[model samples]
Target: MRIGINLLNLSQDRFGGVEQYITNLIGHMADSGENLTLFLFLKRKLKNVFPQHEKIKTIRFRKVMDSADVYDAIKKCKLDLWFCPLHRSYLPSVPVPTVATIHDVLHTEYPDFVPGGLEENNRYYGQYTASFDAVITVSDFSKSTIARQLSIPEKKIHVIPLNAPAIFDQAPAKITMKGVKQKYQLPDSYAIYPSSYNPHKNHLNLLKAILILREKYNTTIPLVLTGYADKSNGVYQSVLQFIRERSLEKQVWVLGYVPPEEMPSLYWNSSFLVFPSLYEGFGIPLVEAFKTKTPIVCSNKGSIPEITDHAALYFNPENPKEIALKMMELLNPLTRKQLSEKSSLRSRHFSWKKTASETLKVFRSVTRN
Candidate 1:
């Protein structure tokens, strides 16, 4: 089958879970000998992950002022199936089959999370609902949300859990401790919070928890913040303000954007990983933490409990005291070791090779008349 993977969202992103999913899927599909032709689109930031795929046919569409330019490109390609790995609400301009992955509906869960979020979220949801041949989601919770919000049948969506890179499940690099430590400028026994500065990530509460931890522990294990700060959203700015207001400039380090290769090392050097996201379809960072032997302190909200599955400590996202208490436990050597052990065990449940094989099965099942 001539499967066309939409490189639209993957093209534009600066390395996140969904982008990694697309890149991994396409790479694995190429190796699987499937006739998968990626409709490769380029954005300014995306590195060439599809360079070696002979089966992948790339079409570059300029970032036109009108969305119709993108529409015209897809229709003109005349693909038998369009696989959109990164979620967007692009309607099909042609009758050929289109499959999309909807990771989450965050704005619906926390409308106040970002500016103009609800309207855009609803607009995207309305446009893409039932238009695809099949929809893919990371968790059952998200499937129901999509079904209820979009008014699409639950059966119409496929549940494919997100996968981690082999690097995460692989052995940690034997780089010098000082090298990695100096790279992130991290002190001993610090915690990690790997996420964009989006509000639904609920980082403000993390700062509050950090303050609580500081008052209790009286140590400097900074909470490292990675990912792009969307100035338009004000989430990152609010976090900065909160830090300054509390004289936590030294306690919270905003490492604007870390390259992908450096991430696993950061995960290894940290004492533990904390994800206080208010909502998520699937917590990819938690899985990464698991794979890298990093203990976790994640929020009990959204699909975090489902995703982590009792592998890590959970706290109410809104409860700063509870979050701080979890961090305290995280800092304790024995408890951290136990959580890290459990993380290793839980990490086994996910893999990119398995995800790729499953995704291919879906393709065969759908395309076979």
Candidate 2:
């Protein structure tokens, strides 16, 4: 079977989780040992992003290429099925059956977090999801949200949980804590929150929690933040402003956009993972923490509870006091040890290979119809 993957929406290191999902899914699919030919439709600049695989064919187009041009190229492939890993549909129509991975319905659920608000989100996400033959999402929460918010049938949406990047499995062995600490100027021990500075990520609340920990409990907990910290982004600017206003420069270290290979070291050396995001389709960082046996204190909202289950100590993301309390609880060595063991057991439940197998089944089923 020939399957075309629409990856034009991605750029190297730009989209944190979405990019990881697409690249890892493709890598596993290529190595799945299935008799399948994969056609990748991506920008010319991303030619070297994906590894050279015998079963994969690259169809590169310039970044300036319009929808019509992209459609024309996809049509030429004569594929049995087309998969759009990212949420939105890039093409109006395709010759073959189409499947799209809608990671979340965050835009509609939390309009304030989105840039142009409801109307803009509806324009991009509302109309196009139903056009696909099948929809894939990261969690049951996301699947239900997509179904209800977009008016798509629940039966049409498949919930496939995501795994941590394959790098984490081997990263600890390769990375040195001393080197990673020196390179990033990280404190001896700190909670790591690996997420971009999006408004919905609730970075402000996390920082506020840090301040509360210091002022109320007189306990100083160092925090190391990783992900894209674009200076132009208002959320990022606001986080910096909060850190400065509260005199949290010493307690908080913002390490923007750490390399993927080095992430495991950060987790390995950290006291615990602190995820204060108000929303997530499926919190990938939680899984990463699970894989690394790193204890986690995260928001109870969204797919977090669904994903972490018994592996994490939960807190209300909107409440700085609750978040601070959870952080204090995680500092207990006994609590951390128990959660770490649970995390190891939970990590066994997810893998990229399983994700690839199930995804391939969806492709075959769609094409066969």
Candidate 3:
């Protein structure tokens, strides 16, 4: 079957979660030999990142996302089906069937965390999702959330889980870790939290938990944060202020946005992964930590328990004391080692191949209907 993918959402910031999802999914789909011809739709000047294959072709548009050029380019492709991986419908009404992936309805669920408020979210989903023949979501939780938020039938939403990026499966060499540590000037012992400074990410609670670990429990290990930080956000400024007021200059290290090349070593060298997010469709970091044989201490909210199972230690994300206590438990070498072993086994449950095959089924089903 021939499929046209809306790739105009991808940007140079390849480290963005959704961009990584698109890149890895396309790569695995290309290698899987599913007898599928893919036409990638992107802006004209952007370099094509996917591999060149007889079955895969790049279609360039003058403008991307909600543009006449995007609709014209996609309509010209004349594919059997169209898939928009970025969760919204960017193209105009087309002759072929349409399937779009809605990662989550975070804006509707937590309106305060998102800008433009509920009215903006209503218009966003109303315009983008109304024409799709079918919808795809990352987890069962997200499927339900999107169904309620969009007032769409639950049966129309297909729940297909995402796998960790391919890089997480391989461990870095000890020398590579040492080099990375020296280059970043990272602390010798630290727990890594690789997420942006979004309000819903609940960074404030994580920082408070780290402080409690230091003062009350006397755990001197620093917390390493790696994600993009914009100074304009009040949350970002408040985080820095909290660090200063608490005298945690040495105990909290914020290394803004590590590249894809260095993420494995960063995960490999960390003691464990701490993801105290208040909400997530699916925590990709949980799978990454499991792949790296790094134990996780994350929130019990959303899909965390569903994804991690017994491989992680759970805590209420809002309670900093509970987060600290659970984190403290993982500090034990033997316990961490056992959890890490279990993590490798659990990581086997997810893979790019499985994700692609299941996604292909959805695409095929949409065409059949």
Candidate 4:
């Protein structure tokens, strides 16, 4: 079968979980003896994970301005199915079968955090997905969220959990770790929280918890924040102000965006991983922590509990005291060792090969119908 992968919405600057999802899925499918074609923006660079295969073809465009362009492209390719891994597609209609992955309905769930609010969300998740033959989600909780919010049948959504990037599964070489530490000027011992500065990410609460850890609990482990920090956003500005007003400049290190190759070393060298987000689709970082055997302290909200499955300590994200208490609780050597073992075991349950296999099943089912 000829399968077409649409990557029109991929941004040049931002390479987050969604980009990883598409790359892993396509890379695995390319090796699965299936005919595949990728339709991406003209100057965007895909990672080295993609292998050369005779079955794989790529078509590039400067930009897709409207549905007619996408529709015409697919018609010319004569593909049996089209897949939009980014939850939305430009085409209003397709000649053959089509599937889209709905990562989350966070826009409608937390309208305040989203840029365009509910109206734009309505177009993306509602109208765009309604045109597809099938929809895929990262977790059961997300599947239900999309089904209920978009008014689609539960059976129409496929739940496929995301795995950590392959690098997370391997131990970084000692020399590489040392270089990464020196290159980024990382702390000797610190907790890492890898996420963007979004309101729903709850960086403010994490900052509050850090203050309590330092002042109330006498904990000295600093925080290492790594992700794309949007200086344009007020939330990012607020976090900076909070750090300054509380005199936390020395206690917190905001390492804007780290390269993918440096992540495993960063996670391995950290004391632990802390994720205090108010909501998430699948919590990919939780799995990354599991793979690296990094003990975790995260919120008991959204799909976090569903994904972690008792592998890590949980706290109420809104309560800074609770977050601080969990942070202290995991500081014990015995507790950290035990939880890290459980995390390693839990990490075994997810893999990119399995994700690709399950996705292919959905594609066959959709096209056959």
Best by lDDT: 2
Model 4 Cα lDDT, one tens digit per residue, 1-369: 778787766665767888889878887877776655544423235444345666667666655555576677787888888887875554666778888888888887898788788888776665566677888899988988888888878888899989998888789999999999898787888899998778899999999998988889888668999888678877789888998999999989888889999999989988899999999999889999999999999999989999999999999999998999999887798999998999999999999999998999999898772
Query: Judged by lDDT relative to the true structure, which candidate is superior, 1 or 4?
Result: 4
How many angstroms is residue 193 displaced in model 4 relative to the true structure, after the best TM-score fit?
0.2
- The candidate with the higher lDDT, 2 or 4, is 2
Residue pairs that clash (backbone atoms under 3 angstroms), model 1: none
Off by over 4 Å in 1: 9-13, 41-49, 63-78, 216-220, 230-233
Candidate 2 residue lDDT tens string, 1-369: 899898777767565888888888999999999999899987888857888999999988776446777777777887889888875545766777888988987888789887778888887765676678998899989988888888889888898888999987764654486788889888888899989888899998988898888999999999998888768989899988998988888888988888877888999999899999999999889999989999988999999999998788999999999999999998899999999999889999889999999998888888883
lDDT for residue 168 in candidate 4, whole number 0-100: 84
In TM-score terms, candidate 3 sits at: 0.94
Global CA lDDT computed for model 4: 0.84
Under the 3 Å rule for N, CA and C atoms, how many clashes does model 4 have? 0
Evaluate all candidate structures by whole-model CA lDDT and list the values in order: 0.77, 0.86, 0.83, 0.84
TM, every model:
0.90, 0.96, 0.94, 0.94
Let me know the TM-score candidate 1 reaches against the reference structure.
Answer: 0.90
Model 2: number of backbone collisions: 1
RMSD (Cα, Å) of model 2: 1.6
- Runs with alpha carbons beyond 4 Å of true place in candidate 2: 13-15
Positional deviation of residue 252's Cα in model 1 after best superposition, in angstroms: 2.4
Q: For candidate 1, lDDT tens digit of each residue in 1-369?
A: 676666655545466777777778777777776656656654435556665667776776455466676667667776667677776635545456777788887878788874567887787667766567778888988998888877778877888887776666665557744577787678776788889777688888888888877777675567888897667758888988898999998778889888776788888888999999989999889888988888998899888999899988999999988988878777689999999999999988887777777777776666662
Report residue 320 deviation for candidate 2 (angstroms). Answer: 0.3
After superposition, candidate 3 runs with Cα above 4 Å error: 64-66, 128-130
